[model samples]
Target: MTIALRRDEAGSGPIVERIEGGGFRTQEHYFADGVMLTPRRAETWAGTHDAAMLDRAAIGQLLAIWGEGLPEFIVLGTGSTQIFPSGALRRALESEGIGLEIMDSRAAARAWSVLRAEDREIAALLLPLA
Candidate 1:
């Protein structure tokens, strides 16, 4: 996806123009900003994609990183398959008033791009197939 970032007249954050690539391979994601992120060990956060940070400690890490910028919901892509997180993890996010949607990486990527285009507060956590 080629997301174009346009600067608002008031100079707000760059607006996403396009987003591409949902299929995961080789353990890398090429973002619209031209940054290539390779996540290893299932505990990495690339942009909005978090691999296997489902534990309490890892969840805390996410809270720290997002802080006040936490989105209304998060899309978690479990590699090439759809795997739901433990109930404990789900409850944790729910306790924070955040919704979680689990899907495959491709679906998550597509949803993330669409939500972003609509200016919705959302995040994506994707696990690569490699």
Candidate 2:
């Protein structure tokens, strides 16, 4: 397979470049802004196309990059698919004054690109689900 390199609406891809600020850059994919980690499936998780619920492991990775603690809003792209988060996780984050928005991988990639340009501390999680 061949890869292309160019400034795209989603990301730069084909060749993954680790952006200085955060996130992985490529021709068509821009993964998490801080570090691109391979997220493992949480136990007992019923996956959805529009709502891939985030488990503690994924959340931990997000928080680590979000060293500033809680961000104004967090955009989670549930893999290549877009799955909403489980209710418990949403409520938990809300209780901590964090805004969470679950979008599909594509939208999440776009969202991160837009947000990163302005917000220096804002972070995102983008993964591809099988």
Candidate with best TM-score: 1
For model 1, state the Cα shift of residue 110 in Å.
0.3
For residues 1-130, what per-residue lDDT tens digits would candidate 2 score against the true structure?
Answer: 1222233343221223333223345544554322232121111112232344465455765566444446676677675556777888888777777777787655665566555444334445555443
C-alpha lDDT of residue 23 in model 1: 33
The local distance difference test score of each candidate is 0.51, 0.49
**Per-model TM against the reference:** 0.60, 0.58
lDDT of 1 by residue, 49-73 (tens): 3444465455564455454556687
Off by over 4 Å in 1: 1-53, 67-69
Which 10 consecutive positions of candidate 1 have the poorest summed lDDT?
33-42
Q: What shift in Å separates residue 6 of candidate 2 from its native position after superposition?
A: 7.3
The alpha-carbon deviation from the true structure for residue 120 of candidate 1, after best TM-score superposition, in angstroms, is 0.6
Q: Could you give me the TM-score of model 2 versus the true structure?
A: 0.58
